[model samples]
Target chain A: MVKSKSWTMVKHFEGLPKLEDFKLEEKELPPLKDGELLLESVFLSVDPYMRPYSKRMMKPGDVMIGSQVARVVESKNPAFEVGTYHVTNVGWTTHFISDGAGFQSLPKEWPENLPRSLAVGAAGMPGYTAYFGLLEICNPKEGEVVLVNCAAGAVGSLVGQIAKIKGCKVVGSAGSDDKVTYLKEIGFDEAFNYKTVNSLEEALKNASPEGYDCYFENVGGNYADVALQQMKQFGRISVCGAISLYNDSVPATGPYIQTYMLFKQLRMEGFLVTRWMQRYPEAQKHLLKWIAEGKLKYHEHVTNGFENMPAGFIGMLTGENIGKAVIKV
Target chain B: MVKSKSWTMVKHFEGLPKLEDFKLEEKELPPLKDGELLLESVFLSVDPYMRPYSKRMMKPGDVMIGSQVARVVESKNPAFEVGTYHVTNVGWTTHFISDGAGFQSLPKEWPENLPRSLAVGAAGMPGYTAYFGLLEICNPKEGEVVLVNCAAGAVGSLVGQIAKIKGCKVVGSAGSDDKVTYLKEIGFDEAFNYKTVNSLEEALKNASPEGYDCYFENVGGNYADVALQQMKQFGRISVCGAISLYNDSVPATGPYIQTYMLFKQLRMEGFLVTRWMQRYPEAQKHLLKWIAEGKLKYHEHVTNGFENMPAGFIGMLTGENIGKAVIKV
Candidate 1:
């Protein structure tokens, strides 16, 4: 029998999700069937999308749905061998029975001596999200100005670096001075701490004199509106996520932006990475190549132990995590 | 000698625009030099973008700028002969002198079947605006749900029809019952009069069950918020214009859609059609071909008399005109 400790949703939230909403449950795993394998969770990803999506998709009394990097310990399935690393969206469980489905076996030919935790991060889904979102949707051209928020984080960091590789001037906005410094270190031409800024519009105008050509939006609210006022005549905005108001008790009712969009004639689009899942491998190939060439870098804030998953998740929602927030099991 | 009368801006409006804001002045004819060609205005194209952009780009007491199709009545240059038509950004002038290099010349090949007024309306900027804005920015795929506000107007009408041609189910929202009917008649899968609807979200929920994949937003405020909530995963929003909140004195707000963009992982883009000026011929060729094949249709809300251009503009702002608002000077 495989021993497992799982974080199950014991309650739901109205505003900011609380730790009490989750319960630490202990369970015994059954023996692997002929086609099944026993896997141990090595890492768990805690993302902002899960919070709102859980309120709608997942219910109370269920293991939180999330992606993880795991190692197969024992297997009746020949495809998943012992000590093999695989990436799966298997939620917060410590051990799971796998039937060799919904799991991608890590390639043996990956860059020599790469960390396995990144299989759930930069070299994985979020990296591909930034790749397809910026290149395909935003279509930033050479000499164009590209701005991305959460600049030091997983997706934003990759987005800025990718734009830099494409020969575009990259600008980024993060929550702290350290994060802002981190963004510059990663090749961003301009980076600002939104927290220290008096006005987002003023900050943007001060940074980009001709206005931003393309914006990869991850943070919403006043920040988006501020960027809106400083866009070029024909700008493109890729709306990947709005982290600012994910846990809002009320709705956003500040200055409206629809008029500005029409006046500037800007284009804004939102995307789910799954929309390009068919082209996932293509994105991964480009991203990994960049990584190998030292053109792309990623950071993960790993919260030690499976018991700290909820704290890791809440910290990410509050913009506390520096990069991709993960719970190391 | 060329005689001309042009409307100059007399004052800025505090609220509703009046006749005093503009003053029509006739200037005595100046003899055309060797390189000058005298032109008479035949058609004037009026649009919403001029309202706010003028406040920034144009100073008070300057001539109100607009585009018109003018006939070269007399010319001292060999480059332009009599009976040739040219489109000029010559403002509210009845007659002017051009050097033939300043304005775009309209070809005289197909004058019999096509309307000359189309040079300032459908065959010109607004038509191409609808074409590129809908196709390039939105990029709607087959079986996708497309929502267009101001569906009976020039750009939105074409957007709905083109979306239909692209195999997307289109829903349109208009301000009046007549416009709603017109939208339905123009191949819109569903059309609703927003004026009669009690709640925008409810109407959207009723019209789009599977959720919207592309939204061509012309009217903003509550309408935009409602449409945003209805967007599916990875939805695309093309912000063309916002006629709804243009005249408001206070900052606009409603629906609080910041969280929705992130939740749906939505993408909204705003674009000025003029950004594709270098590619105008490409879009024009496609639009003309669509017209030739009867795949596209358009309407012009013509207001005759040059002196009454302000009246038509005010009416269009109040949502009275259905289609491309223009003045037959």
Candidate 2:
């Protein structure tokens, strides 16, 4: 028998999540059945998506939903070998018994020196999100300008870098000066501290005088309203996340944007990374190769210990982390 | 010399346009030069686009821009013979000399029994706007549910009807009970008066228990905010117009909709009909055929005389017209 510890939501989040709202629970698992495997979480990811998704998908006392990099400790399946690392979405659990279903091993060409936590970060969901959201949706062309918000976050960081790799001028906005520096270090052409800016409109205008061809939207609200006004004709907006509005109990109201959209002939689309699940391998292959070539740089904000999962989640939602927020167990 | 009488904006409209904002000016035209033709306006169109466009495109002294079906009274251009009718965008003018640069003649197969005013109504810009906005942007698949607001107006009525023709279940919302009746008369699967509905959400849900797949958005504001919530996953919104928001001196405030759009994976695009100008003939061909086959029905709210041009325009913007609003000059 194996003892597994997990975090469960005591109640649905009212606004921002609180540490008291999470309860630690433990259970002793029965012996693995045929073809089942025992796995222990190595690195657990706490993304911005969990905040709003929790309200919609989870009830009180439900285990916090998330993805983690896990190691197979014991296996009864013929195809499985103990000690192999894999990425799985088994929520915020320390140890889990699985039937070896929905477990994705790291890419075959993954560099041995690189951390496997990347399976839930750089070369994982966030990477795939930046890949398709920018390339497929925004479709930035060479010499064109691309704008991204949440510049230091997992997806937004990759989005800006990828836009650079595609020969497009990239402008990014983040909450802090440190994040602004990190953005510049990762090859963003222009970076701004949105919190310190006198005017967001002026900041955006000063960054790109001509106007943006593509906007990778992560923080929606007043930011989106202002950014939309600065889009060139036929600009495409790929909305991957709206971290700014995730904690609002009631939606924040802003200026109606239909007029801007109509006159500019803009296209705005919202998508989850899973929309292109079948193409994950293709995205992972590119992400791994780019990282190996030093073309794609990654950063992880790891919170030590599984006991700090709720704090890690809350911190990420509050924009405390500069990159992918993960718990090292 | 032919005398041309045109309506000019006396001043920029502060809110909704009034008669005092217009000034009728008359000028005598010189004889037509080589390749030029003299035409008299037969039927001038008064559309919702003029309201918003007037603010963006016209100055205080500029003529009110619009399209009209004109009779070629005299011709120096051999290509355009006298006594023939052509569609030209010459603003709100009764008589003008054209260089035949932007004149479009009626389709060759136009039925003799059908009124030529249809050139600017059912078979004209409104028709093309509906065809491409719905077909190209919404791209409704067979048996899918389509939701169209402003379902009795020029472009929207055609959108709902076209969705029906494509074998989709069409739900429509209009301002008045009579407009709702007109929607049902035109083969809409479900029609409701948005003004009379107790709750717009319930009305939409009752109209179609399953959510909408293709949303032809003409009326923006609260309607869009509510409709967006009820969209099925992967819903495509074709934003042809925003008549509801056009009259606002300052933009109206509304709930930020990025969350609903994100989880639903909805795509919302705003367009001007002119974007598909290259494919106008393709749309006109289908529209003309549909009208001839009695598959498409059309209604005109004819405002008599050139003198009522401003009133006709204001009335159309206020949603007084059930279908295409045109002035007989």
Best by DockQ: 2
- Each candidate's DockQ: 0.57, 0.88
Calculate each model's fnat, 2 decimals: 0.73, 0.86
- State the displacement of the C-alpha of residue B129, model 2, in Å, after optimal TM-score superposition: 0.4
What lDDT would candidate 2 get against the real structure? 0.92
- What TM-score fits each model? 0.91, 0.98
TM-score of chain A of each: 0.97, 0.99
Residue B26 of model 1: what lDDT? 88
Name the TM-score of chain A in model 2: 0.99
- How good is the docking of model 2, by CAPRI class? high
Clashes of each: 17, 0
Best by lDDT: 2
lDDT of 1 by residue, A233-321 (tens): 77888878887766776776777787777767676766778878888888878888888889987788989989889998888887787
